[model samples]
Target: MSDKRQQLIETALELFYQEGVQSIGINEVLKVSGVAKKTLYHHFTSKEALVLATLETRNQRFSQWLTVQIAPAKNNQELVEHLFQSLKGWFEDRVEVLGEFRGCFFINTAAEFRDSESEISRYCRQHKSDIKQVIRQQMATYADQPDETLLERICLLKEGVITQAYVAQDMSGPEQAIELLKGR
Candidate 1:
């Protein structure tokens, strides 16, 4: 990626996370990204293209982070703890002495632009599906449990933890969720 295009993606992500995706316009991203209109257009044919790029960037970062987090775990139990600890770490990082922190950018964006048929929405849906698949794979490492039941339970718990931690401002919510999932 060109420096200009990379700047646009990074700046757009900051603005989108701080504000919102739909609320912020293409002109705003261009202005904030410090890229000329022609440069922006050269990289993205339209605002929807930029939006899809932004979502894909976020999805790539998330997948990379998750892969790193779960890489060291030996078993499903350790894997579950690693996942919860990662969420807790996010909470500790996101919440400083200041006010509340912004929640999951993807979840926020999905809510703001719910189920649209746009390319951005399609990328968002694919990212979510990938997330569920990751959980299913991890759950499979636990053996002895029915695959369907474990997949459903773990996916639900993961979603609940993500929402409760970010939206509900419960710092320990992810850890609590892990315990709940283990009990199940």
Candidate 2:
């Protein structure tokens, strides 16, 4: 039998990403997942708990997807190319892990959970930090030293690209980011 907890997370994650945490409710998750409310409650104490679980699962899968997508690069240039190429793939709906681009999930979640001290807000910050760590690790193989400034810029560029792509329906983001990287 399929795990009811995982089913809930997958269903809720899709709904929350497509809509937003504030917009989706527990009843919808139950209906979409076909898991009884009691079963959902058995695994999660509350909807907020379920949201956290969904974010955790998404973060894990996203890190793996990103790592694989950029793993083939041989140099900084290629790393940048691979990064943008991967983003282009996702933007084009080719990245299955991040079905249908809806801006960054963490960004969306953070926007809804504005209290910096809240668990959701903290989780969002941690997710971004982990992504930056991934970038640093990937860049380490090619660079002589860890470049914090470059790391920060890359993170910023990535955020901007996702925003532009999602908010403005601008698909030129990856190319623009690539060109911008070349200037750095």
State every prediction's TM-score relative to the real structure.
Answer: 0.85, 0.95
Tens-digit lDDT track for model 1 on 19-128? 88888998888888779999988998887777778788878777767767766765666777887787677667753321134777777887787558856667777998
- What are the RMSD figures for all models against the true structure? 3.5, 1.5
Cα deviation of 53 in candidate 1 (Å)?
0.5
lDDT of 2 by residue, 1-184 (tens): 2498899999999999999999999999998989999899889999889999989999998999998887787677777788988998898899877898888999999999868899999999999999988888888877778677877888899989989999999989999888988846
Each prediction's whole-model lDDT (CA)? 0.73, 0.89
Report how far residue 89 has shifted in candidate 2, in Å.
1.1
lDDT of 2 at 131: 90
Q: How close is candidate 1 to the true structure, as a TM-score?
A: 0.85
**Pick by lDDT: which candidate is best?**
2
Candidate 2 TM-score versus the reference: 0.95
